[model samples]
Target: MSDSHELSRRDFIKVTTGIVGGLIGAIIGLPSVFYLIDPALQEGGKDAWVPIGKFEDMQVGTPYPFSFTRVQVNGWERTASSFGGYAVRKSDSPDDLLILNSKCTHLACTVNWSAEAQAYLCPCHDAKFSMEGEVVDGPPPRALDIYEEHRISEDGIIEIFFKAG
Candidate 1:
């Protein structure tokens, strides 16, 4: 009964060995785990000058649709999301352009241009927006969001400064 209540020498050695082994494993493994995942944990640059199309390709008074993919890495995951928008040339001048995000302000549904109706129509709701991106009717609280910063590159490619929030 006394022997059963007391820890044997072999049991003490086994317990101490397990604790030391576990501590050693954690000390070595934790840093290695962090090192392996450090790149994924760090945030990547989301600001970029995204090329839409050739400046000449965008016709005046017409909405030219364009799309691009943005890849974001979080932890061990990599997600690629596609975003689209419309670019309208207001005049022959390279600076005279209107770049609008396709996402409706109300519910984020993609808005399509109605050539016949001459407005952007949201399928989710009956929201209407003018060619100039102003709200014409329906549930939208404000005008369509525009990419305010844009430039025509020296190669004649139109690019908009895209910044992710």
Candidate 2:
């Protein structure tokens, strides 16, 4: 008795073709899909030292306002964020430069240098810092956030590592 339930040649070829086709599709398409999503899966918390301006541009005994745009790589996207700070050249020497973040330590409000008051004034919570980033008055836990890593480039540009808190 021949209980034949074996597959025909045509059916066998069709099944093998389908498996092979699927594998080829995966080999080609999978990498494209991974590449598209790779940026999104990358770590976002990274900071770099960036040049803000020339060391000579900062006037002696005055806090010079500086702003720069940098790309922040976050999950799934690259965003351009504007960051602001102050460059203080106490003297003619580039080594005397002090780079300070403009954000107040009290509540992260933007602080402006006040010539009349002779202090960095945070209008949001009335926090004041002296020309040397010391707490002057009102409510602030510590001094203004100062860039710890900074240097004058060979071209005399003031560069500093900006880290967002």
Candidate 3:
């Protein structure tokens, strides 16, 4: 007498069904998982040369205000923040320009150019900065932030090398 094992029909069907079900689940589930998390896996750009305005639009000896929105993505969250600056065309030459960030150094409040006062005024704390971004008065520890790296495109657009913190 000998003992032997045989593959039963029910057992074979069960194994086959399990393998097919696993394959189908993997095929459908992988792409759905990736789609749901693709944004989180992507890297957000933190630096760019942003175009603000045309060089010709900024008049000589005056502060020209310009604003732009920057979007930042971290994981699944997306946020938008507004940034602006004053473009003071010091002279007729494109290279002779002063680009200053509109944020007050004291409290990060937006500053506005007051032509009558000949300075930038911060409503938050009465901080003042000259047209060249020099600290004029108030509680500011330093001058307004300035964009030192900038260029005038051949098409006359003013672009500044911007970096996000």
* Total residue pair clashes for candidate 2: 0
Alpha-carbon lDDT, every model: 0.90, 0.83, 0.90
Higher lDDT: candidate 2 or 3? 3
Winner on TM-score between 1 and 3 is 1
- In candidate 3, stretches whose alpha carbon ends up further than 4 angstroms from where it belongs are 1-44
Tens digits of per-residue lDDT for model 3, 7-95: 67888898899999999999999999999998777666689999999988899978999999989877677889899999998878767
TM-score of each: 0.73, 0.68, 0.72
Clashing pairs in 3: none
Superposed Cα deviation of residue 146, candidate 3 (Å): 0.8
RMSD of 3: 5.8
Task: Give the per-residue Cα lDDT of candidate 2 at 142.
Answer: 94
User: What is candidate 1's TM-score against the reference?
Assistant: 0.73
Model 1 weakest lDDT span, ten residues long: 1-10
5-81 per-residue lDDT for model 2 (tens digits): 89788888988999999999999899989999987676665677888888777898789998888787666687887
